[model samples]
Target chain A: MGAIKKFMYINRTAPYGSIYSLEGLEVALIGAAFDQDVSMAFVDDGVFQLKKGQDTSKSGMKNFSLAYSALGDYDITKLYVEKESLQARGLTVEDLMPLTYEDQDDDYQEKPSIRVVDSEQLADIIAEQDVLLNY
Target chain B: MLHTVNKSPFQKNSFDTSLRLSRKGSDILLIEDAVYAALKDSAIAKTVKQAVTTHSIYVLEPDLMARGLQPARLIKGIQIVGYEGFVELAVKNDKVQSWL
Candidate 1:
């Protein structure tokens, strides 16, 4: 690691409908490999990116939503879902996929990674980042 | 703020909207298909050229190359940046607003 910079990847678009969410995830993974402190924010329609039971068989698109769970494996475990975005869409955390990963530093125990936060908290996170990539 | 637009200007209003909303001195980065707007003779290019006086405009070099757009074909005064430059711009700005 040269210099670890705080990096935040913001997702505001829905997955499948556009390439932003998928491409945003790609950047998050790449940021992790660079040894930067990586965090993800799901806002607006982006909360759908974490929705459970996504089947793209008919759409002929690869269901990359499952890749959200793999974020923990990459040590990019900070996933923030905006509370207001979900409420506005009439969705709750239950509607999202339960994302967890084994904590290698803690006896390899499985633990949840997603954090449901308010817009204020999300703003703080955004302001604290050294770099923010919005998609 | 760092305003990034990845949609093609011809197909989307992101560039026009961002240009209107961005404060003077803010930076604009055109990436992905949005790189097409940097074509020297395009209408979007004319818009961007006008925007350059108030905002710093940049085109993602890799995306331009991926779309087979030569640097010489880009409008004058727009800077071309790589992924590293993308990171640098994000760090340089206080916040980022992606114009979807």
Candidate 2:
């Protein structure tokens, strides 16, 4: 295994506006294959990447929001969503997709990995990462 | 701080804004099209040279090559790094701010 470093992926762009959100998800998935400790922080318009029931058929672009729900299967369970970002967009956790993972340990109980944090707490999380990749 | 800029200076003002806002002695890594700013004799190169007086600048080698820019074409005082060096910079810096 490679050196296990703390990696925090910062998502600050909105979904479908630019390619940042999808590209960020691609990198996070790639990082998971490396066996590093990976976490994601949703700030600014990045919180929109997690909104549920996104219909992109009209735009002819593939809707990739469902990929966020599958992240836990890769053992990437740390997803920090900034509270202020969501509130500024007039969204709540209820507007996000229901994401839960079946933990292999502890009898495979399902648990939610999405964490709602304030800006201050998110700052702390950013400070704690060994590597921060912005997308 | 290690600042990574991936946008072109001509298309976006992020490279200029990053130079304006970064603290003195901060390192800026020009990746993707931002490497164009480091090209010798370019208009933005002069401003980038001025930035080198206070900030240590680096460019992603692969990106430069991908864009068909030769290392010799880059202005003095700017270094080139590969992917491993990119990770090293992230580790060496206290914080990283991306110019998006």
Q: Pick the candidate with the highest lDDT.
A: 2
**Stretches > 4 Å off in candidate 2:** B1-100
For all candidates, state DockQ relative to the true structure. 0.02, 0.02
Overall lDDT per candidate, in order of appearance: 0.80, 0.80
Which ranges of candidate 1 are over 4 A from the true structure? B1-100
B1-100: candidate 1 lDDT, tens digit per residue: 8999987665579889989999998899998667767766544556778988888999987666444456776778889998899999999998999998
lDDT of 1 by residue, A1-135 (tens): 568789989998766657888899998887788887888999876776786666654335677877888898899888899998776544578868899878778999988878999999899988999998999
Query: How far in Å is the alpha carbon of A15 misplaced in model 1?
Result: 0.5
Superposed on all Cα atoms, the candidates' RMSDs to the truth, in angstroms, are: 15.5, 16.0
Window of ten residues with lowest summed lDDT in model 2 chain A: A52-61
Which residue window of length 10 is worst by lDDT in model 1 chain A? Answer: A52-61
Per-residue CA lDDT of candidate 2, range B1-100, in tens?
8999987665579999998999898999998657767767554666888998989999987666544456776789999998899999999998999998
